[model samples]
Target: MDYNLMREFADSWGLVAMALFFVGAIAFALRPGSRKMADEAAQIPLEDGRS
Candidate 1:
């Protein structure tokens, strides 16, 4: 089934692509306004005091 070839390909570009995706996700999660938006959304129900 050519396991060696598959492993080599995965180790080459697959690893790089995974690392890039992780970095992009982290950057997006840490971006500005993300936390502020979350905080505002959380306060909406609280201001109304209604579950």
Candidate 2:
């Protein structure tokens, strides 16, 4: 619970955890067949109140 212990953990395992999360997110964003969903998501703001 001390500052040094927390800082050491953050400097080591925290960096690894963040790096893994970043790579996973990049992989998800670039996966196959995601373009259609991404395009649809991109248009959500332009759509009016109509369905």
TM-score per candidate, in order?
0.66, 0.91
Backbone atom clashes (below 3 Å) for every candidate: 0, 0
| Per-residue lDDT of model 2, residues 1-51, tens digit only | 999999999999999999999999999999998999999999989989775
lDDT of 1 by residue, 1-51 (tens): 499999999999999999999999999978998999878888987696655
Give the clashing residue pairs of candidate 1, or none.
none
Worst 10 residues of 2 by lDDT: 42-51
**What is the TM-score (0 to 1) of candidate 1?**
0.66
Highest TM-score: which candidate? 2
C-alpha lDDT score of every prediction, in listed order: 0.91, 0.97
The residue-level lDDT of candidate 2 at 32 comes to 97
Candidate 2 versus truth, CA RMSD in Å, comes to 1.0
